[model samples]
Target: MTLLYEPERFKDESRTKRSKRQLLLTKAEEIFRTQGIASTSMIDIAKIAGVERRTLYNYYNNKEEMAIDIQIEYLRNYGATVEFKINHDLDYTKQLESYCDTYIKRFLNNKNYIIFITQFDYHFRHFSMDDNLDRYHKIMKDRNMTNNPAMEIIALICKQKELNVDDQLIRKFFFTLHHCILGVAQRVIFRESVFIEEQDYSSEDIQILIPILVNGIVSTLPSYQK
Candidate 1:
């Protein structure tokens, strides 16, 4: 007797596969955070994920691929959050402030992930940024977009204020702010706060730096006036 195909069964199977994949990813993330990525193996991941070694391999070709997938997922989430914060009816300065503060807070919250990704790349002799940027470019290319989240937000603010600037200038401005934020985050993470004298920098101190950095960058624009 011939059996009829059940679409619901197929849907359920797909959902199960996705659920298992996410579970493995989550377990791998935890192991990477605690034991460090360099020390984590496929067996360790499978044991932590409570899956067979073959099952983990079925979802990912190898551990590096799995780690990259996790990083991409994180970046996508980060981009979405930035887009949500910036895509609002508020004025440009307010939007910029929100963007800056959100970025700082997010990085501070995920400092471990940030450090893990960085160390993973160093251990593997890979540049995770290169991989991340390649994926970012592909997505942007598919969407017929050029600027990243940071660049797009900065451009929006400039356009709203009628600040005339070329793409190159806008890019420079974006990188300037980007590096500033990263520098501040690095300092805080490493317990080497630049401006604050305390060994432990408070969130309030970081909040104060956001507006100062934003205003410093804004003040450099040709259209900006004292």
Candidate 2:
């Protein structure tokens, strides 16, 4: 006779697996924050997690795989918060200002997570990117569009303001300004001087620039009076 399928038993097993995975991630994040992912090892994670090396291997073949999972989860949660804050009905300038404000506010509030992200970006360069495409694919899949959310928002702003900027130019503009902002924030959190003693920048300086930069970009649009 064929055996009966035990759905409840399978569900319990799934929950156990998820719980163990979460425990491992929690321990790994703490260790990665202090030692950096490049300096971290699977053995370190397993030891910190209080589990056998084989247990970690069951969830992830290696540290990079585990780190990728943590990174994706972090991005997904942060993206949800951002999507919730965006007022789609707002005008172009207000919308962009809101987006910038949200980014700065979140970064300030979650300094440790931002630090992890900064370190993760550096560590990610040495690893193969084949398994790292989950976040990108999810973003594309969710939006069902060619451009990323930022690019789409920028394009919308241009259309609303009747700006003559090319789509490629907008893409370039966003990436350039974004990296500048992120780099400044990262340095501030890292407690490094931002090059000007006495008038040296803080996260507050980054905050002040957000509106100025938003307005600066908006004012440059053909429709906005410069």
TM-score top scorer: 2
TM-scores of the candidates in the order shown: 0.68, 0.71
Collision count of model 2: 0
What is the TM-score of candidate 1? 0.68
**Residue pairs in candidate 1 whose N, alpha carbon or C atoms collide under 3 angstroms:** none
Cα lDDT of model 2 by residue, 72-117, tens digit: 6666544323442445687766777667777778778777767777
Q: Candidate 1: which stretches are off by over 4 Å?
A: 1-13, 80-91, 109-112, 124-163, 190-198, 202-204, 223-226
Worst 10 residues of 2 by lDDT: 1-10
Total clashing pairs for each candidate: 0, 0
Please give, for residues 1-226, the per-residue lDDT of candidate 1 as tens digits: 1112122223555756766777888888778766766788999999988989998888776777667666656655543234434555767766777777777778777776555555455655653343444654565345422546666767776777777778777777777787677665555664434435655555446678778977777666756422
Of the candidates shown, which would achieve the greatest lDDT relative to the real structure?
Answer: 2
**Global lDDT scores for all candidate models:** 0.65, 0.67
